[model samples]
Target chain A: MTGSKTTEYVTLVSNDGYEFKLLRSAACLAGTIKKALDPTSGFIETTQNRVDLPTINGVVLEKVCEYLYYNQKHAESRDVSDMDIPPELCLELLIAADYLDV
Target chain B: MSGRRPRGAGIRGPHSALTDFLAANNISAQEIRDSYQQRVRQAEQEAAQTDDNGEGPSNGGAEVEEDLQAESSTMAAERTRKRKRDQDEAIAKIKKGKAAKKVQKKKQKKNSSDDDSDFEDVMDMYKKAKPLPGQLENCELCNKRFTVTPYSKAGPEGGLLCTPCGKEMVKDTKAEAKANKPVVRRGRRKMESNRLDGMTDCGPKTLQQLCIEKLAQHSEDIDELGEMPEGIMNRISEIFSKKRAMNSTTMKLFLQPDMDRVAIHEAAYLETEDYDQIFAICPNVKRLSLRNCCQFKDSNIDYMNEKARALEEIQLLGANLVSNDKWAELFIARGKDLKAFKVEWLDAAFDDEAVEALTTFCPNLERLKLERCKQIGPDSIDAIARLQHLKHLTLRFHDPITREKLTHLIRSIGTNLETLCLEHFLDNTSDPTDDVLATIHTTCTRLSKFRFTENNECTDAGYVNLFSHWSNPPLRYIDINSTRDLDNTNPDGPQESPIGLASAGFLALMTHSGPSLEFLDISSCRHISHETFTLVFDGVKQYPHLVEINLSFCPVVDTHVVAGIFRSCPLVKKVVTFGCFRVEDVRVPQGIVLIGAPRAQDLIEQFGEGSLDL
Candidate 1:
């Protein structure tokens, strides 16, 4: 399943009830949100529709979703495709991605 | 050979039947295993008879494996009873005198202190005692029973012994002592000769080779000076220039220098002034494999810029290429004629931006391998998808690509994709689902090789869905081993097993007959089983193009089933059943090669003399 197409600003409710707003491309990186998108219903609901979708809680989901959004924005805004973010931040993302399975 | 038993022969037991059969004539292949089973049954019968008389161990099955041992146990019990009787008789004599002395002491002692006083008195009585000359004592040399004599008392150390016994002990140890003396000197000489022989085998070396060899020998001397002598460096330069002038690049100036020890030299070279000179010195060099070259930075790219036009391969597998991204990309783009590029960045981060640059810079790239690169995700995959000509792509331990992204990427250039290796690809957001499988099945038409070696996301159903389509029968190699989610239980409830691939993914492959498939290696995928094998091979007659199936390191296959599969798969070339314990004979289809059955090459390599030829 492809990630749910999001507007410029979108809301995500994590398993713990935390909310995150992010770009559609960034949200697509999470395989769970991708499966949540119901083409016929047009309302992307993560839980009941996709039984196989990994249930992400609010706290972790918020943080990981934030990372996806930030990384995507960073790519678009930077005129130089060769620019690199802080090495420490990259290590943090790797650890977070490993944990969330994103 | 004649098939008659010798006349008046006394067979030992039930096992004798098999022994007689073996002696009678050549045994048929079908009867060999059964005869062995019959021998086991005979041993069990003998054990049962021994148990009936209470002559064997309480556990009847204990002796079922050893008939001769069962008989020996009865005799051992009789001997043990006799030895106990002898030990009791000897104990009676030794206690008789001791008992009298103990009774007398007890009669004299009425108080608690009296016992201690009596014990002291008994010790005093023996203080000055000397043993009789003919009395037995333990020999100090060998600790054996011997008569005490002048020869037994060798100094104050008490060398009590029989003369003959002492001599025997000395004789026994003399050869051992001689053998213990070091033969290491001979070993060193042999090693030295071996080294000399290895050197001579190179044959007819020139003056340059001789010089290089001598330099290697004197590397320690050169290192002791803390630096190369100025005279030596100058001489090396002169030799290099002379060799270049003569178009003789064959002479390799060999000097063993530690990478850490050359840190100072590297620092000096890093000075901006020497950049041009560095390029001039290694102008023709194309491939560089660096190990902990901390001094080498992105700034060093300028030194190799001149050779970029002719550079086709740049392998900086592990280096600090990210420090100067502009120069790095410039190096990548400048090398328009590049064919292969393998670079590993220590930095873990990668997003669409950096990958976008890589994708744009190396558009003509055919093979791209990224390992532990954390920042890139499905978006980066899209960039790779943009590369229409790309053939081999390896993305290891990356975040999982969503079904949509995978679908898009596959649609972009999946037809040209020959091999896709995704190891441990995970997306924590969702567990594996059907969409992912559908995306792969619908797209990626020309995929001949797919290796999802380890993925935490994939489940049995996911694999079943992916493999069920099986329209792309051309896919020869698929490694989905080590996936824990697949349910490989046989309909009989895990009764029989095969390689680990016997799981749901294995059965999934069976749903679609692979007509042209070869090289199916499913090692250590424990879920593989005979149930899966029967499912696949039951319809093998229709798909006669199959060959080379590897089920090694899996515990499945009895001799009958193994032989049956060989006979069934008409085009089966090689079958590797290294771990199939029940198989003991190699059998195959009449014309096709059998490589993995009992006596087949693969099984032979694993079981017979540890060699390939059986």
Candidate 2:
């Protein structure tokens, strides 16, 4: 951590008080996250380098964070069948994905 | 670190917080299983109790005796009676519960039916309820956010729109609807007027009453009539004939000088002097068509031969009074400039000598139509076929010309032929054979419009060979209706046994020349199947100019093939499927006119009239 350098990590706080730290490039895979954390926007989330999603819960947020990193890693490749999801959390994950527009 | 598992290893594990909460609340799968087992045990115990009651006093006698030894016999008897009363009360309570459940079910059904009727009313109320004036909605037309009011109108496509855009849309639709309204004709207007008169009398109008009113009105207007348009003039002439009102004055309005063409169908009232007066007035008339010319005598043609010397085309129907020598003289005088000649329903005065004179003199003739001429024979056709410059010829012969003569006729003048319509009279036995088709295919390379009907000798092989590879440009109009093989030699065989223009021949034609075909009438071609139609038109994309198709009597044309036609030919405007019974419940696309099918008609009526591009 140099004093004058900008940070690359973005903090996403869920509604149920779970915070996920992700790289800015990985977090920008989601369109809503990218908009909220845009540096040129005058939103408080942009200034604080953090986004608070009041609609998504902790479990869905964790899954979404995992998907963001996974998507970024395999963005150049065609296959993404390695990503696994539990059946019980599928409905909630879909709702979160819709809200995030990913 | 023992609690930490590998990534993605907890896919089926207790991953979600909802699952965790459910587990903590003792709502696990095992708990549900235990509750289901408990319910089964209770049901089984009730069934056993019912069985014991069914066995009655015989099974309970041993137990009752055992109880009597411990107590007095009368006390035991009273206890047994009390137990029996309790069992009857329990059974009655179960029956009452079942009846209550049935009533509740019936009430639910009734409530649903009521909701079905009230649903439309509720929707109406919702539509009538307007939002507050300050509420904002996006304009459906411009997509711009604007403040909505109670008076805001709906857009053409059914969404709330701003006031200015709404007004513009309404004006546009009003103009369009006005433009699409049909122009009423004079005949219909007269009928409507007669209907209104009947309505004023407060009674239903019979056909006789309407005709009487029409005639009474016509007589009052005949005296004061002024100059009218040509269409109205023709309509007046037709009405005069129908009402038996044609006289010298009405006949004189038809003789206009410098008229280039004249078609007079009501020439029965005209005497030979009137004919001479018409010939003198309109000498420059190049085309003259006369029907019901019973009063036209042989001398009238001699008079016309000298007066109307510029006549290039003549159509005479029922003009038997004109002698053959007069017709020959007229052809001899004006045949150099004659281009079209048609004679129909002539019993006499149009015989083999007149036909020979016509062929000998009319070297520049382009069109000739001879129908129902009983005296003309194969020799006259052979003479008529000598004109090499003929481009359009329609021959509907009452006398059966031999196949050899027909073949020779086609081969002689088919080089420059553009439209050839050959229809045999139903009474004629001789049919043009496949050799005639072969001759046409080989010689008539410039043909564009062809119609061959009522010919039973042509077959699918001839059609296949003719359309396999044509040397001319793609044909724009083709009508080969009812040219089937009528000799059903095998009466017990299938109906669709291959006939003229079967699936193979039709597909060959479509694949070879379908791009430029604009109007095709393949009605009554019964041998074409649904599968072949789909296969030929499924993904073929060349028919961009096709506008009208008539598959009226084709039995195998189902809905799927119709849909395929709609999909493949994007510019198709009219489809006639009159007797195709398999085509039901068709959803005709917008802007395409569908003529038959009751369900398709209902759909078109429900969604306004379609626009025909032709």
Candidate 3:
């Protein structure tokens, strides 16, 4: 909203109305973040000086935050090689990451 | 000097100690990389080696790399999480911290650049070792690391060993086998005391007395004599007495039913007169050895046809009655029911048709000997090829069969042909080529015993090509004699085809053939030298499958080479070097039969009895 462009970050709201805040770089790993960021609410408020972002709920939003946090940590350290991650969890994480694109 | 950080309560996740424990237990690099304690073992090993060597800061560079790799993962998540929390705080603090957040975006960009370098290094290492983690474990016994190697034999314990260790285990079992050699415990042949000269005396003679009296032996006891019940005996006596009173006593004696062995032979004598009587006499005779039964005519063979329902075995030695086609049909008919019928001296005009009928009718026939049968040509061989059920066939001294035709006959039959005895085929004057050798080698892949003696034409190339295709090679017994054609450097004038020398041919055979071969016999081939024997024995050692070798009459220089064969091929079951003078140094294995300086007649006799099973 300012003349100087600001980097976008995401806020995910859980079904139970809990909110989680994440960096746009890390939150971009999830497709659900993009959908939430699409701004479907009716007001579409214009911030003359600052962009007023929509608030996300907490419970499901906490899970999305944990997943993005782990993925980012796994990528940076490349230490997932030693992860004796159970096969079921590994498969579930892979599919979830793909659905979220993280 | 007070401590600022917490000591033992830093982290709950697995640390360097776990990796050090895994290394002590012999888990491999791949397993370590897959386990929870990757950095711990590498760090520990580096630390231990540096301490042991008394080297300081020299190991510092690699440790930095390790620490960077670890800290980067935690930092990446820490930055993103911090950034999100800062953004949430910024939403509220925008009015207050508009002046304080001037350098925040620049700091965030610097953090991302650090994460990029760390991710690239880990990815590079992953690419270098395209390791499929958790697929293999370190072998405990070898103390060496390898991936999965399939094991054939079940181990004493449950799991499998690597290839080299498996080979060692198999060698151990072979060593145990070598320790126990089979001892020959032959009982003396059963002596016959009841003479065949119609001697029916009722004397209770001792075994020593019987031997001195030159009496044949009886297998059964006196209690087993053919006896009827007393009531039946009384009835027969009354009938005889009544007939005698009516002057019919001679008629009753003439009507006697029992015919002894002598009477059977006598009935066989008059082929036209007592044809039915001969079959009626000995209907179910088990063991019949007609030694030089010269009077056995074609009509006497009718006894076989009539008693075909019960006759078990028949042997005809030097039986000259089976000369031509007149009795071929009758012999063929008898062959249908006979389990075994061995006809020695089968040198007759018995051509293709007779051989065809014999082979067709005798599907269950076990052993056949057609020795000195010169009249049997390629046509007879063609017929024999169709008899897929024959286990043993000896066609020795058949002068008409050449190698080319013999190979053709073999190819037509294929693997169903088990053992073949084609001797003296090389005595023919035709020149043997590589094609003839290849044909023989290719077709006789399934042949177990191959006896090629006195065939001067088979060259070194033939032996090589024949042996090179020995992946599933079936030769168990082989005999190569008088192979002097290989020595090109002849002392007697100039050699004709100095190319005809047997050295090259023998060497070719030794190089490839000794590996899969179980038994070999090379006697009376004086040109066979020390190099040939050494090559074969050395080949045997490398391959480890050869079990038996015979180098008879090989005029080699040193006897130690023969001894070396025994030392090298420990699995060898037999070593028969009969006529070879230099076998003196050879320490033969326990059960191995070593026949030195044996005569040609004895050699022939041993070969005739067939190969010894190791």
Candidate 4:
């Protein structure tokens, strides 16, 4: 928790005990994650490069992480296709998107 | 003859099947044709004797119609699985057997190419013919009885097909669709739409903005925006509001109940009962803002009065359902603690009595904005004079108030007011009287923003008097638009008084507030001459604080004046020149936007992509 060096990848722990290790650039696409990892604010997440999103479960968090990477990859591109999302998981993903402010 | 192979007498070779048949029956091609012609002639004579309107065409259309029926019924099915090649071949054969109705549809389409209703009707019937789940139906191609399911596919003909045949058809169509992916042409209209809601930077949007937009696109699937920050929630709600997707279901996402502020930017989709949920859930809410709340009735007001006791500020727009009495009651209940209240777009209620009640009860109220309240008249302005602690006052009534009452109101509440906005006074006469202007000048020394617009009454002398170093330091925002003389005959406006913000008044304004003015709108102040515009915005002088200036409808403004303005205001981001026709061309710098110009609209210089200089 007190580590000073910023890692290239961060671990996101979902509530159902699933941890996702992803690129820092992709993870920062989410406003919530970005603010948490903002070094100037000096939250524990900034030093450790890990955040426990307690409310979001494993399935939705996985999708959220996938979306973060997708958004980062297509940041400067045009004619990007829509991401394929399962209809059943749409509502939960939407809630997560709003919460993370993706 | 023997070389031509007509000599069966020369060689006892095997004869063709037709020759053998002809020899066996002793029938020639000529004899067969004569017999067919005789039969056709006999039949024609019989048809001529029995003429009727039943037969529209004698082109064997009835047989083709049956073949059509076979193809269409298959189109009407739910595609489930794919069948094999031989089954597809059999299904194709069945298509020809009962294709009766489809051919007739084709004939109708050919007859009247413009109208599609006839074809659509048959398609509609075919669509409805798909067998319901748990029903027994025979397959169109095989005529084999099978239990119908929701996934049952329509055969190639006209009825629901069994699983194998249906699946084959679905696969074929899927492949067909995959092969023929059409290119979508993205024209300028698409780019303009992207500029709306979405963005168009010098290049693509930033990563964060893209993610935010994607979230907004799939907002309906959102269950709740759980535990998000207030600013982000507000932003999400803003996007949702713009999309008009903020219905009862989506509205709950914005209610961070524990937080003091709850604002719904678009509440037009929310119903009467939806308003109740806010009170029930967000009991601790202090500042409640809802715009276009059309269904906000007396019941919701009562609910808020009872439950939202912590409420100090409430801004509601288009909540006309609350009667005038209810408004007074609300003020009576919550007015002591209320600091700011803005209620607008009232069609019938919130009259003079409501304003009187607000003044009488809400002593602690510091900000009050009432706009487009049709029932409120001059008496409401008179009532507002009684309030002592108001720091900001904005009023746009449906009826016009006299200049005398406005002056009295200003004199009474002007000292405490930091911002005073009065709109649509629209008086006809050119009284050259500066009563209200004089009152504002004398009393409102602390005012930073003064917006009094849509008037033809205040003359140039009044504006000059207001600004000529009498009292108030410098206004940061000033919008005195459409205050010119009304008479088209005397556009010069009485030579002595100079009605509206003419050359002298514009110069007076610049002399007073130019350094501190961040926003200034002297639009429709046509009396200001070309020389005055040039003098006011000369290239030498710099207006450091001017960020946006609207010179719309100022006829005297030309390219020279516009260029002068650009040179003068260094930090100006937007310059609106709507009706200034003489401004045909101007070089807009990067980051600065020139809107409604003849030659340069939204002209932002492309960076890192300009044509190479020779």
Using Cα atoms, each model's DockQ against the true complex is 0.01, 0.01, 0.01, 0.09
Q: How would the candidate models be sorted by TM-score, starting from the highest?
A: 4, 2, 3, 1
Question: Which should have the higher lDDT, number 1 or number 3?
Answer: 1
Q: TM-scores of all models?
A: 0.39, 0.51, 0.41, 0.63
Which stretches in model 3 have alpha-carbon errors above 4 Å?
A: A1-102, B1-295, B310-317, B325-327, B335-342, B348-353, B359-368, B385-392, B427-429, B434-436, B486-516, B538-548, B571-574, B583-593, B597-614
Q: Write the per-residue lDDT of candidate 3 for residues A1-102, one digit (tens) a residue.
A: 342322465454444555555676666555544543444431222121122223333433454466566555564331132222333232233333334444
Chain A vs native chain A, TM-score per candidate: 0.46, 0.90, 0.48, 0.95
Better of 1 and 2 by lDDT: 2
Q: For all candidates listed, what's the TM-score of chain B alone?
A: 0.44, 0.58, 0.46, 0.67
lDDT of 4 at A78: 52
Candidate 3: deviation at residue A73, Å? 83
lDDT of 2 by residue, B464-566 (tens): 8888877867888888877666656852223543557778778878876798999898888777778888896684565898988888888888878777787
Indicate the worst ten consecutive residues by lDDT in candidate 1 chain B: B260-269
Model 1: per-residue Cα lDDT over B362-424, one tens digit each? 677676676666666677778878877778777763566665666577677766777777676
lDDT by residue for model 3 (B1-614), tens: 01112337676544487556744543434432433354666667777887888987465758675675667556544655675567555653553233233333444456556766556544544442221222343454664555554443334553445567778889999988868857434221211111111112222222122221221111111122123333332333333233222111211221223422111211112333243444555565543444344556666665556563455455665556655654475556666555555555555455667767777777665555566655666777777667665655666655556666677666665455456665666535466665545665666555676666765566555665666655436466667665445445663212333222255556666555555566676766665557766765552355355676666656672456655665566566555565565444333334333444333332321111212222
Which of the predicted structures, 2 or 3, would earn the higher TM-score when compared with the native? 2
Question: Residue A94 of model 3: what lDDT?
Answer: 32
True contacts kept of 2: 0.00
Each candidate: fraction of true contacts kept? 0.00, 0.00, 0.00, 0.09
